[model samples]
Target: MTVEYRPIVPKIKRFKILVIKIVFIVLGRAFQSASQHDEEIKREISSWRDGFTLIMKVMPDGPYMGLEKKNNMLEFKGSKLKQADLEIYFRNVESAFMIMTPQMGSHQAFAEKRMSIKGDLGIATAFTRALVIVMSVLYPEFIVKRLVKRVPPLTIKRAGLRVWLYTLGIVLGR
Candidate 1:
């Protein structure tokens, strides 16, 4: 009897790539929209290496999102860049989703060994803080509280600004 053998790894890789692309698209929109209206976000993004790329990936050769900060703007491209200043790797797709969905905070994911980061510590920390700020602008207060290690106090003005930024983000198809 003859039997057919098929590898599932390729299919899994494709799925992971699709998920990562979708996530990055949403994140890219959020960053671009927030930067336009929030000086703090613009400043934070500008601190990075000009044209520097940050890639977030699911490890074991999974999918990745390549993000570049240039001209004080954050943009996401479909494919991985040749080089990245920072690479944040999740052990697997589930691990990536756990943190991305706000079910587990990023700090908790790192503490639990679900993530591996390669880059300068200082730059990574600053980038993380910038992500937190971006999250605050993208998501609701309760969601942000769950996703971040520490939720900063939000003033009325800042909250109102977030609302406007979010509206702009949606309008811009972010």
Candidate 2:
């Protein structure tokens, strides 16, 4: 008798999951290490706060305010910020992230509800916009690219489709 080798999708999935787990662990550790050196980030951000006011709906447990400057001063709530010479807002991190992400155009999610803002809308918009810009610069794109490159051969399209299907299934209780 002889045995035949077989390719199994389940095995492939398990392997993919393992790979993703390893990637996340490595990235998480890297972040933890980098955070220990955050004084540099603090200095960089402090230099940017030359002329700006920022209000944040800080998580009860989070550091309450962030003032940063790039080409101009910016105030960040969570990561939300205003960019004009003088800008302010009372916003939370969720709102900031939502406004800055591509979701701003239409898919505005949870930000408005989760955060409260009482200030100049124009300046607030500037703050969020500037925060987006500074964050883009501060976040290491190279790490992101490398992490993405490590993803299983599954393309983003496939991943997105899988997520959509999974979501649908959960919603439909299938």
Candidate 3:
């Protein structure tokens, strides 16, 4: 007796579903880890004990959010904090993450008005310096191209350059 083999469409469907589930789980874990990292940074900053409220209103729109770390507890508006004393402002979500990264200064996004820095100008400067320290300590971007390559895709690299040129022109009183 000969046994007949059947084509397995159902099996293929099941395999696709399994793959989708696995992908979702992996991505979810990555996002959670990133958020936890943000939280850890916030906690570390709070340790500084500034005792001043940093109200960061995401501009060109009225998000109206604030970061206040009076004591050990770090509180934010809407209870949507995964981090501490640092308040991020960006034109969009992608730019926000990019600015958070080290070697970020080369990117046009930071130089442009797209990402604005508000509150505690001294602390903001300190934060960037501290980031440099942390980056140097943890993972140094010694390789030039490797660091520059990580810059996010801005709509126009020329935009930042133009702003720089215009600023220089004004300073020179042209």
Candidate 4:
């Protein structure tokens, strides 16, 4: 009996995982920056107790990103994979990518059965709002229009925030 040769699936998955990992790295930094700078994000997190942790990870496998609230600002826990107060689990890499990119939003992903949550719904809601605020600042107007239900007004301040994200947030992770 000849065994089936299935080399492609593993390679493809590894590639998808890598792409997702990079996206998560940038995402962690963006979240941290927004928490520190955006007034909306600050207000959103104000209710959360210090040390609040959230993790976003793909299901049935490895690779995860953790974010925690400390000193009233969000911090990226790059090497962390611990139990969080709110954990957002993606059924697969495609689902995570779609949600992470402007291709789709978190609400759509959940409704489509591509995502799941384990923890407090209120925290998740607040986190989603914070993420929406961050994404709007990071992406351009065209992409943001599609990523969010309502596009934030194009202003000099928003443009500057995007600039800071590129030069400092994504780069130095500040």
TM-score of every candidate: 0.78, 0.30, 0.35, 0.88
Q: Which stretches of candidate 4 lie over 4 Å from their true place?
A: 1-12
Model 2, position 78: C-alpha lDDT score: 30
User: CA lDDT of 63 in candidate 2?
Assistant: 23
TM-score of 3: 0.35
What tens digits encode model 4's per-residue C-alpha lDDT throughout 1-174? 999987674445777678788888999988887678777789999999999888998886757899999998899997475779999999988887777655887767778888889999988988888887788888877777776677656567667778889888766666
Kindly list the per-residue Cα lDDT of model 2 for residues 49-141, writing each as its tens digit: 354444343233322333333233222223343333342332444443443332231112224454544556655553344333222222344
RMSD of each: 3.4, 19.5, 17.9, 2.6
List, residue by residue over 69-154, the lDDT tens digit for candidate 3: 44443233332433334554666433433433323442354567656675566666544443332232233346323434342222
Which candidate achieves the best lDDT against the true structure?
Answer: 4
The TM-score that candidate 2 achieves is 0.30
* Cα lDDT of model 1 by residue, 38-123, tens digit: 66667776667778888877777766767787677777654657458888889988787676765777788889999888987787
Cα lDDT for residue 5, candidate 1? 97
- Model 1 lDDT, residue 161, Cα: 60
Which candidate would rank higher by lDDT, 1 or 2? 1
Residue 153 displacement in candidate 1 (angstroms): 3.5
Q: Order of all candidates by lDDT, from best down to worst?
A: 4, 1, 3, 2
TM-score of 4: 0.88
Q: Which stretches of candidate 1 lie over 4 Å from their true place?
A: 1-20, 80-82, 155-161, 164-174
Error of 3 at 42 (Å): 14
Candidate whose TM-score is highest: 4
Candidate 3 off by > 4 Å: 1-49, 53-86, 100-103, 106-108, 143-174
Give the total clashing residue pairs for model 4.
Answer: 0
